[model samples]
Target chain A: MMLHNALDRYHDRPSSIHDLDPRVKVVVTLLGIFSVLLLPDGAWGAYFLVWCAVLAVALVARLGVGLVLRRSLVALPFALVAITLVFTLPGRTLFTLQLGAWEISASDAGLVRFSSVLVRSWLSVQMAILLVATTRIPDLLHALRHLHVPALLVTILAFMVRYLAVLLDEVTRLLRARQARSAASAQGKAGGSLLWRARVAGNMTGQLFLRSLERSDRIYNAMVARGFRGQYVTINPHRMRRRDWMALGLAFAALTMIQWLGRTLS
Target chain B: MNIALLTRLWEEVVVPRMHIPDGFLSMPVALIFWVITVALLLLAIRKTQQQLGERQIPLMGVMAAFIFAAQMINFPIAGGTSGHLLGGVLAAVMLGPWAGMLVMACVIIVQGLLFQDGGLLVMGANIFNMGLVTAALGSLYHGLAARQSKGVRLVVAGVLAWLSVVAGALFTALQLGFSGTSPFAIVVPAMLGVHMLIGIGEGLITMAALAFVMQVRPDLVAAEAVRTGGGRGWVIVGLVIALFVAVLSPIASADPDGLERVAIDMGFEEVAMTPPYELFPDYVIPFLGETPLSTILAGVIGALVVALVAFAVGRLLRQRAAAA
Candidate 1:
């Protein structure tokens, strides 16, 4: 259920941005991320503009801005890897720490770069979250196909999305079963040595693989019975409208302005 | 340590192996990886189609789903720590390398789009590190022992799985170092240190899963193992290229500092001091004063330790398999 909530973050809101073509949304999101990456480090003015643009897009999509911002915190853990730059980069020292025999200093330049990495990644992830929240998985896959993604790869993606929930359910069931059997220790922890616990999890994984393989065979047979072919056929395909093109143009203009501001301000 | 301090330490140390986000990588670095990823993926698509044909589509898709699900199932490692499966080598052993790569790529792309787990622009790097490299190692190492005894096969899988994680971490650190998000001297050790332990967990899980599958459904692994067994010339070439990169990374780290020294000697101090152009002081181990030699020495020592661990794990898995 938790995984389901994570996967099904899309909101069925009716707004101009929400109604935009999925392909347009996908391309615009990618372009936004690229522009964010291109911005100079410590360019707070440019980053502010980009975040404003993203918030505007969120508003247009009828999604709650606070919720979108909160959801994007998933990127923060990864941003910690850049924290090393705070001490490693050479610049005017803000402070120095004596740890035993070694002296370490944090630099003004390193702090700028580190925070820039965090802000840039945060803005980029917010854009991505907006794209997913506004677009359905099926429509996104269709957009990928229309955008000239390889046919087989698209098909593979389609299958993956379709079965993700089912497989996740199976995984949950497997875990629950393990929990029931796993006796607790005096400290109320799962009673097992490291090796034993690993063996259990690995065995469950193997079982899951076997079931998935056989399930795939059954799925293939059922598809064939229903006159399924090698390629998936869509009943109706989405087409870009005038507003979709207009939205894309607006996004491009905004991203370019943001990048220019970033360069000039930094 | 208090519970809060322990949890904070865990969060800081245990960075995930893949799923690099946006803004971490510079544009040129991201673009270079994108190009490399596209080229390799095109080859993978062609090769998988040639080998497995139409049936691979659904099968690979389901396996991708299975892998995604499997990643959620964490196993205890040591001292209340846990790690989950990446399933790259597992997929490669079950499917061939090309299909395995395709499966891994699909999972990463979906995670990026749906969960915002990785950046769209850097998906290429993620795929290259987590998918392409791991699958290649799977085929190269595990493929060699395809016809060996059951114990031998499991041992190889364990070691290869460990190697794949370390290699993925190394590639990621290289990318981050190149992108200027982190310095090489710092991030390299941090990533490698965490992943060395994580890689052990990877090894144990890989060995356990393979041992299980071999016991319950031997033919599944055997069939694909044979398929990848022959025609290993390309695999060898790939190994050579990987080793070349591994050897060159330290030199690459040292060369810029060397240039900075030369610039200083030539009285171009201001040019060398540009913030973006990082003229870092030469990085060296504390005991070893020189840059390149110390770095290379550290690398060799690290490799030797990893090799020793792999040898021990292999021996342990071999005995377990033989006993079973």
Candidate 2:
């Protein structure tokens, strides 16, 4: 996937949700994840509620239903793995099928477990997607810093996000160069050897590492010249507005309601 | 190695090679792994600062990106399950082991946090399994092998890559066993059997990658060369062994993995969870199933959207900073 294009989408006008303080968003997202994960494994109803709540949040945030569904799809594999357990699990078999040497029997408990996993994953992923969609990476980092996350970790994340596109660009360029050279060599010879291709790919990776190191040294030297310090200072401090507090209160209320509903249902 | 020593090393030093994903692990096991991961991450940051100065930041960032991109590409393996290079060991061989660990740790952290690729609580477990164990063990293997012949070093690299996966799988089984999810006897053998095959793929990829690095930019392999006393013979030897292992791996194991085996043996097979709305029961969206196909389509679309969103965010920050 093209890294630059992926990054370019984040620059959209900050939605009302995006305008909220990053801390509020972070807390809400964490709460959403925690609530879903804490649901009992067999609690399919609780999971459905969570799914509905996530959909509601997405709707309020004006995030496209299609987009949220798409993002949640990343968790599909785990869901399938859970589904497999339904047939493989031994219990009062809901249904049985004989295939080759294996007898697959679906269990009611297995289906419940699968449903719970599916619901939990969907809710958690929605929260994450919404959080990332709303908050800029820098704002998120700033929030992380204020939340008492280690400065080094935050700095590392910020830089990694920032430089990812650049690195991708460099790799792409390197690949093109290699492809051109390979095609020329192949034209001269009948076919390119697999051994040679492997060696060439290996060389490119090494070169990339060296280039990255050299770039870092240069960047460091420049920073040093500009009176570099160990840590970076925020240019514009993120202030928590009244709306931010309101958002946080509402999130807490929603979570409390969900927990109460879960208890009542159980 | 003595059996006791081997067991100790496997448990303490090597086994947490980091390939196991979440949902495969129980909650208690995940928590323990998380605790260990956090502790190791704290240690890694401290160690990194001592060895690397300001110059390392950009380098670390670029390397993290490279690893991120590399992970996206998976090569098909046996049993319809695909495998990707863990790359922690490979990264460690080039960068110092600690620095390599730090990079891997960051990648896992981001993957866990952003993509929800792994669970938040179990992130530590994932990090320990993938980053700390693999990098440390791979580095150790390289260090010792380099002392012998270059061919031996390559073989060691390949073998270690395979071993790392086996080690990772075994640790995962132990965690499951310890959590009272599955018995050790069933879990261990099952995990070891499949991972041994997977490890061969890992070994080949790693050795080939390392050999290429050695040939192209000898400087990137400088750290490794220094550790190996600049032995060229051992490097070449290592390359040959890698080729041999790659050709031999297909004939190895032809069975379902440890997790699958335990899943089949224990009635608790239903305990394993998959992501929601996934197309195939495994994560792959079959070229059929409208709901699952749409989901896969959405993922491709979502990835594009995420990339765009991330880029825009970066540009906005840069602009705001410049304006300020």
Candidate closest to the true structure, highest TM-score: 1
DockQ (Cα-based) for each candidate: 0.50, 0.14
Residue-wise C-alpha lDDT for candidate 2, range B154-223, written one tens digit per residue:
7666766765665565555556544333333333344455565566666766777777666666555656
Q: If you assessed candidate 1 against the hidden native complex, which CAPRI class would it receive?
A: medium
Q: Which pairs, if any, clash in model 1?
A: none
Among these predicted structures, which one has the highest DockQ?
1
Model 1: share of native contacts present? 0.69
lDDT of 2 at A213: 63
Instruction: Please identify model 2 stretches exceeding 4 Å from their true place.
Output: A1-11, A88-90, A173-200, B1-25, B72-84, B146-149, B172-194, B223-324
> Interface RMSD values for the candidates, listed in order?
5.8, 10.2
Q: Chain B of candidate 2 versus the native chain B: what TM-score?
A: 0.61
Error of 2 at B85 (Å): 2.4
